[model samples]
Target chain A: MKLLELQAACAAYGQSQVLWSIDMEVEQGAAVALIGRNGVGKTTLLNAIAGVQKLTGGHLKFGGEDLTATPAHGRARAGIGFVPQGRHVFPHLTVMENLTVGLAALAGRKAVKESGIASHIFDLFPKLTQIKNRKAGLLSGGEQQQLAIGRALAGQPRLLLLDEPTEGIQPNVVQQIEAALRRIRTELGVTILIVEQYLDFAWSFAEAYHVMQRGRIIRSGSTAMESASEISHLVNI
Target chain B: MHESAFLIGQVFNGISVASLFVMAALGLALSFGLMRVINMAHGEMLMLGGYLAYLTLLVVPGPLGILVAMPVAFLGAAFLGGILELTVIHRLSTRPLDTLLATWGVSLILQQAARNLFGAIGVQVVAPTWLDHTISFSTGILSGLTLPDTRLFILLVAALILGGVALLINKTRLGLYVRAVNQDRPTAAALGVNARLVDLTVFALGTGVAGLAGVILALLGPVTPTVGQSYIVPAFLVVILGGLGSLVGTTIASLMVGLFTALIEIYVDVSVAQVLLLVFVILFIQIRPQGVIAVRSRALEG
Candidate 1:
């Protein structure tokens, strides 16, 4: 079953239209990569999916439910989690506090405990447990990324959208994040959609690839089938 | 040199006044600290609590009147705060300066309404028989200064309220959500924190505390429609001096301002003392522009 679908999604920032007639989908438990160069509406696509930005004209559905009219908070409540670019963690909050903030959205403490989902986030990103007491702002870039992913996972989301998780991180941290994403897909069964500028880092983790240029997806195919030259040409690597 | 006995008396008076300021300033600080709103009308909310207490005294028996008025003032002011949140504050959340202006307008409207309904003159609030007495302790060199029971009661109540607020923010899950929202709105919203609900609840809670302060103020002395204006400046001073959004800083600042104002009123001219205090505050702000305790947030960088 399709976890998320965007039919001719169109969006804008005030007067400027950034996303034009975009269509995309992520099937259940599928790991999809949105690969594009800068200013190619990659982040804009994630924002639209997360309901943070309004669609000028389009249809957005999640698990077959029309989510076009849903607000960002309602989308969050409906299990669509977004890890925005720049790892926007609450700097003043402790790691535990950040996690707890997400946990508060659960129906009750009993449901939270019954799910054991928060522990799954911690298990995926073990560094979070050690730095639970430390403020998020003081964390390293990689730790902040982990914290950001961990925060989203705490919400027990069915569909997770990550925007440039390894954009500015070191190679070793990128590896850790890739491993965490694998575990998230295999163990927790989360449908993952990630936007990335780096083809090498993203191609190994994503099952399918969508190449966007100038606010439109120009190519879509299996990650294994796409040639390195084609990928380089698409992302201008 | 000031006489030891005189100094002791002044200290006692300062402590009592500080306790009162702490009551009023803590609520103002909490509201602004968490919400980043000046809530210029917070003082008026306090004044409303005082007026409610006064009105309650008219209907209830003397001793039980003040007791009954406390919760009523809290709920009344909380409801008003909630209404303001829905009507004005909710729209002005992103615009701090606009919120200050809008709430100030609300405060003016409330004050003028009070003036029309209750008359412009101050209405006296009588203390219950238990609080009417004074307690004195004896020392060898000089007799220890006496303190009013009502003042002592107010002090205890302030301590309790501050303690409760501290616990709520530091320990409770709701507080964790508030702190998260204060630190980063976008991140909190992404985490499913429902930033709007948290904002409304925090504003209402802060205003409720203000109402409690108002009730305590009513018990302290007379209340007038314009009474809120008097505390508005001091509340701002306390919030800024203590550090933005730091409860501990607010408590210490409240006591310091209270004691300083009381001492100045005693030894120096009240107006001159206020001027000196203002100068000191200005100097302090110049030294620590972020406040005694800074509001830590990534958004603050840009």
Candidate 2:
């Protein structure tokens, strides 16, 4: 089943069109990476999907339901969880509180115990459980990244959208995140649609890739490229 | 010995005054802290609340009526604030200066309305029986200390309110939504939190609390259309001194301003103390703009 589909989607900022006629699709439980150069519509597209920015023209469908006019919070309740760029964690709230915030979407769901959610999150990232009492702002960048993902997961989303998770983090932490994403995909079967710039980092786990340029998807296919060098050439100057 | 007793009595007076400052400042702090809007009509909200209290006295007599009027006033003011939010404040939310000017306009309109309705003169809320008398106290070292029953009652009431607000902000789900919106409205909205609804609710809550403060002030003196004018500046000073958007900072700052005003009044002119307090706040901000309990956030940064 198609988890998400964007049909001829277009968005603009005060006369300057950032995303125009973009078409994209992700199947249920699929791991898809969206890549493009700097200043492209990657972030805009993600924002549109997450309902942060309303599309001027397009049809958005998730889980076989229309979502074109839904607000951001409404999108979350419909099982669309977003982890925005720069790890926008609530600095004052504790690690546990940040995670519980994700539960805002799961309020009406049956038997969604808070403790059970914590345990589930801890089971995914044990490092979070260790410092769960600490303020989110005090955490290291990598820890914050984990908390961001963990917080998104706490929403119990069927589909997770991540924007530039490894933007400024160390290499070792990136590897940890990759491992976690893989586990999330295979074990939990949560559909993921990621916007990433790092080729090797994204290409490793992504089952498929889409290249966005000037607000349009120009290229998309199976992950089997000729070589990493070719993939690097495809991504950057 | 008598000098020492007078000093102690003055200190008690300061503490009593602090409670009123805390109560009066609470709503303004909440509105400014969460929404980042300078609500110039915040004082009007309090004035309206006082009028509500005075009106309540006509229907329900005595202290029991005062108790009932609190929730009633809160609801009425909240409803009025909600209307303003929808009509004016919400539209100008993105423009802080515009919001300030718009709310200031609203304040003027409210004051005129109050004057036309209640007249330029003020109405008095009859003091509750329990708070109508002064109480005398004496410790081993200090004798002949007297505390006004009104101040005592108000002090306890303000403390209870502070406790309630703290608990609500820290422990409740509504608080989670509030804090989330306060820190980052866009991110909170993206997380499926109703940021707009939260803003409206907070606006109402703040105005409701202001109504309660008006009722308390009415007990001390008459409720006039211009009563809020005298309060608006001091309440704003307390909010800013406490730190923008920091509830704990507001609480501590209100007490500090209250006590300092009381202390300085003993030795200096009341007007001089006001000027000095402004200078102190200016210096304090210059040194530590973040405040006593500022949260770590990059929400304002590019």
Q: What stretches of model 1 exceed 4 Å from their correct place?
A: A108-117, B142-144, B297-302
Global CA lDDT computed for model 1:
0.82
Q: What is the TM-score of chain A, computed separately for every candidate? A: 0.94, 0.94
Cα error of candidate 1 at position B253, Å: 1.9
Q: Highest TM-score, which number?
A: 2
What lDDT tens digits, residue by residue, belong to model 2 across residues B1-302?
Answer: 46777788888887777777777788777778778888888888789889999899889996698888888888988899899988999899889999989999999999999999989998888987867888775665566777788888888888888898888888998998888888777778877788888889988888888888888888888999999888878788888788776778888887788888888888899899999888888898899787655654454322
- Tell me the DockQ of each model, to 2 decimals: 0.53, 0.53
Span of 10 residues, lowest total lDDT, candidate 2 chain B: B293-302
DockQ of 2: 0.53
Report the error of model 1 at residue B186, Å.
Answer: 1.0
Q: After superposition, how far is residue B166 of candidate 2 from its true place, in Å?
A: 0.4
